[model samples]
Target: MQVCNVCREQTPKYKCPTCKIRYCSVGCYKKHKDSCLPVQPPEPSGPEVKPASSSAVCTDPWSVEDLLNEDDIIDKVPVEKLQLLGRSDQLRDLLRNPHLRQLLRSVDAADSKEDAMKAAMQEPLFVEFSDCCLNIVEDGTAPTHT
Candidate 1:
């Protein structure tokens, strides 16, 4: 699954027509247009380029899934490591993780960034996850996948 070209949050459900890259929202789309990168074509596995059969063409209207890019995870200059954290499932197995969920909920509930961030720091799971994330950085190791 591909992440948003800008925020790298949810799986992309929209594509910018100009660049044909997937972005999650109108805000992200706006942010992306100015810094769009060149498209990368799939590598050729054999000697020559081949033509697609006529059956490959579709007449159906585009849907959200049509915007799904098969590029796996994103790690580009514009996307932050903090935004990449939720996209990674390295802490999904931590029990009592609902507090982290609450932290996320509180971000929407709280009136300001300081309040939401303070609430996150108070979450046991978030604290533990932070320790793990930092440890990975300190040790120069990739985050463990579950």
Candidate 2:
């Protein structure tokens, strides 16, 4: 039994002529051709040549720390960490955090920003109070009948 190249299912066939991979079915062969990375010829591996320095006579290779650059700070601290320092108005920072973005979007109302924010905070309080009253009435936790 031949195995599918894409999904690894068993079938009667063994070869895919289009992608040149062993496939169990036409579907497997087609899927492989659609998404596989293009095969490239292997390049000969050799030691890289370094440019001759005229003035510097140091004989040792410099560590990554020696290559300290402005870009290095960004590479060191992830984008998520930098976002922590950004203001609320920074959309780049907000969008990067889906939870934050969702919270903001959920709060946005047609009225003024202040009103929208106040309303957003009130929703949880309202739900909590409603649930407490409901449970008390349903479970006879409170003396309600008169």
**Candidate whose TM-score is highest:** 1
RMSD of 1: 13.7
Judged by whole-model lDDT over C-alpha atoms, candidate 1 comes out at 0.62
TM-score for all predictions?
0.32, 0.23
Residue range with the least summed lDDT across 10 consecutive positions in model 2? 85-94
Instruction: Give me the displacement of residue 89 in model 1, in angstroms.
Output: 6.3
lDDT of 2: 0.47
Instruction: Give the lDDT of residue 67 in candidate 1.
Output: 38
Candidate 1, 18: how far from true, in Å? 31
- Per residue, candidate 1 scores C-alpha lDDT tens digits across 78-141 of 2354444444456555534676666667765565655677768886777887786665444444
Q: How many clashes (backbone N, Cα, C below 3 Å) per candidate?
A: 0, 0
Candidate maximizing lDDT: 1
Cα lDDT, all candidates: 0.62, 0.47
Q: What stretches of model 2 exceed 4 Å from their correct place?
A: 11-20, 44-146
